[model samples]
Target chain A: MIMTVTLTILCLLLILCFVTTSIIPTPVGACASLIGGFLLLSFIYGFLGAHFAAVIQIIVYAGAIMVVFVFVVMLLNVPTQDLPKVKISLADILSILLSIPVLILVSIKILNWQAPMIDSQNVEMKDIARKMFIDYLWPFELISFLLLTALVAAITVAHKNKGSRYMLKEGSDHGR
Target chain B: MTIIFSIIVFAMVLIVGFHVAPLMTWVERRQCAFIQRRVGPNRVGIFGFTLFGLGQPIADAVKLLFKEDGNPSYVQPFFYFIAPLIPSVTGLAALMVIPFGAQDTFFGTVFSPQVLSVGAGFLLFFAMSSMSVYGVTLAGWSSNNKYSLLGGLRASAQMISYELGMGLSLIPIVLIYQTLDLQQIVYAQSHSYLFGFLPDWGIFRAPVSFFIFLITIFAETNRLPFDLAEGEAELIAGFLVEYGGMRWSLFFLGEYAMMFAFSGLISCLFLGGYSLPYLTHESLIHIVQPILGSFGSIAVFLIEFATLIVKMSIIMLIFVQVRFTVPRFRYDQLMKLGWVTILPLALINLFVTALVLGYSSFK
Candidate 1:
């Protein structure tokens, strides 16, 4: 009962963080909240016996990947451009009104859902490596190849540079 | 009951962490002074009795706490306020997971010295340490100062870059030890020497990992040579340009505390953690049991804890010595060091370790 209550609170906090991320006007604040949400999600994964997944989530997502995300956002200095008026519009209200029944249905499903039995209660790093490399080896290799192609494509597109544009005025701040 | 034990142990760790912040200030100052061939701050003391400047940090703390917390009207209220928190909170949180001493019974409630002990508890340090990026970035972004933002981003960027190499370096150790449990890794080191001279420590087993981890710690902690973030000369204290008084001090305190924690971590991972060079815990307990009698367990626990602290302090002193000696890395140099140099070397080290391990096992 206590464990259930704790997980419930964690899930609620996770939702709160995501909501905060979307609602916050500043880019940095949004990014921070997103990191929090990811951490909470990782914690929930940990509670669900995905120990390898939990730590990797923090290390890869919140740690390395999001740092790069924040770096790009900061480098671009887009918070000024992005900080539009955060008012609920007719489109937002209409979307919400349209989604109410779906939301309720989803909530009902979530509430009624039972957690699956975790066969491996103590999932170690080796078990994860085995599953990824040996069990689902083709999928893993295919995914890596796909990611490599994406990276190559991204570089190809980036290198084409129709015209390089500057965000901040030349005299504003010299980061370099 | 388990929860209660965890809470108590956690609180103890917090106290140690909290105290470490101020103590490190003294260590840095005194050690730097010693390196420079001068008597540093041998003045502040209780009732005018300067105890070799032991009271200096306390005096500094009092002054900082009382000074005006210059909360500028222009800064983003929430991020500015919460920015200092992430570093300190993450440092303390990381401390909770670190195994300071062996398990001991206190009032019949036997508990591990650490709060949380998982299969891969060691990685939790990186996980917590990694979150400190937000603290720097948030401080920069919310401060409404371009220079602060640049500084913050630079610092955060350095941390992120170094973290990759640091995490990669540990793979070899994990391969050699064959467990992610930090306690198990430490226990694995306690067996005996490899040959007749070499000790069975992580450093001996994986010298490349040790070197990589050392360099990355310097980068991760934002210490000198790698401390371009607060380039006292260039960025005017970096992301901390807008901060003052207690707020400014909190950043340093957090850094120092994290440094101490990392020292503890390095000792655990590389050095013979909480164990004598040659003696195991059982032997140590056996040796001391005759002298202390019924207080054997408690005595051993204190000794282990002290051993860990002593090892950490040695690292802390090295930090101070290096800070005073080395010149700060140029921004490009720092980036190059992390990426062009350390990252590839770590990868090579990882692959070599795996190949060696596989070959040895197969043979």
Candidate 2:
């Protein structure tokens, strides 16, 4: 109940702020408001007692991310001329129409997730930890290594290609 | 009754949180001023101008309240907003697992204010805190600004690097206690190495864990020297560059709240929490509980809460002091410290702790 109230209040405030200050409003303002709404929703989720999921949501969605999109946008600098002109051919229209049933089916499956057992609660913290560390340790280590590799790749990408058009002749030919 | 009690506890905690957070700000300003040979907020509250600057924090709050909340043009709208909520929510959630004191049965009901008392509660808290990095990272990225992006990248690398060392470092304490319930861990520390009089803190029993834990605590909370995320001089408030008004305030609250939680965890697990010098459990009840009535059982409860606050304040003071005392670590050096130095040391600590615990159990 408290979490719900908090989320409602936060969302309303965020929306009010965005609408008021987004004087030279761009699509970005709307998108940001939507994201903020979800973030507050997750906080509500945390407050409602899904501690593990809430933290995971925060760390993955809010903490280390959202910036990737920003960086991509900045690098792309989507000018009016650069905007990809969509022809909206018949095939695209047909595909969009065909995807409606698939979306509905997915939503139905999601709504039927096993009924949350609010009363039958016996999941011990030690049991969860033992399983997580001992049984899942190998997979966990592998995932972390993968994340590290991703981090390295991201850093490399960010560093490379600065003034690359000129360096192409000097560096690319040598490397090739 | 349970619901009502939980509400009361929640309200008390919120009040305490709000009160302590601004006080910390005052402490930081006054200390910084002292170091620089300047008088701090002395002109505001009680003395100089008679307002005690007691109203400074309030004034700041009002300003934030009235400020025109602005969103940057380049930000990924969705992620930008989610950023602050992530850290703040995770921080508060982490506290659910922390035990306040020992539990006692009263009138056929087990009444313990220590929220969620599970066996692996300590690990759960650590995991929640580890996940808090996302808030800063996402905010930095979503801002669609260079300064913020750099801050986000740095925070990710720093947080992840330190996380490995921090997790490995805490294993030794787990080995010694052989339990994840924080209350049990504190109970284990009530006795001395030689006898009953001396304290049996984790620092004494497992010094390696103590050292690694301390280092990791600094990194985990993004305190001075480790505060690469908001290297204000360099990053311009880091990930929070684009945030304004109340949204910005949430992030600030989250950071301070995390600091308090980290200190509390450290105190509870390793520093004997509220365990007093030369005082037996029996004596505790006799001296303290009488005035409070059956609420005396709640004596340890209050002590645990106060001890946590005091310990956290001391740590925060140190954090502020260090911010003035030392220069910030270069980003690469920070990484090296976590991965190369702290990680290896943590592993060694774990092994040694395991060996000691094994021997003790067998004996």
Cα shift from native, residue B356, model 2 (Å) = 2.4
Q: Which candidate has the highest lDDT of all?
A: 1
**Regions of model 2 farther than 4 Å from truth:** A1-176, B46-53, B105-109, B278-283, B289-295, B298-300
Displacement of residue B314 (Cα, Å) in model 2 is 1.6
Is model 1 an incorrect, acceptable, medium or high docking prediction? medium
Worst 10 residues of 2 chain A by lDDT: A114-123
Instruction: Give the chain B TM-score for each candidate.
Output: 0.96, 0.91
lDDT of 1 by residue, A78-167 (tens): 545544666788999999999999999999999997655464446678888899999999999999999999999998887675465553
B1-363 per-residue lDDT for model 2 (tens digits): 666666766666566555655667777888888888988876554344545466677666778889998977776777787788877777776766665556654445575657765434576676568667768766876787778877877776777677777777777777777776787787778666666655888878777777787788788777788988889999888877788898998887777777777777888777886666455446677887778877776666677567666776787787788877888898888988888888988888788778867897899
lDDT of 2 at B356: 68
By TM-score, the best candidate is 1
Q: So what's the TM-score on candidate 2?
A: 0.72
Q: Look at candidate 2 and tell me the lDDT of residue A141.
A: 89
Stretches of model 1 off by over 4 angstroms after superposition: A79-105, A116-121, A153-176, B1-5, B104-109
In Å, residue B192's CA in model 1 sits off its true spot by 1.4
For candidate 1 chain B, the 10 contiguous residues with the lowest summed lDDT are B190-199
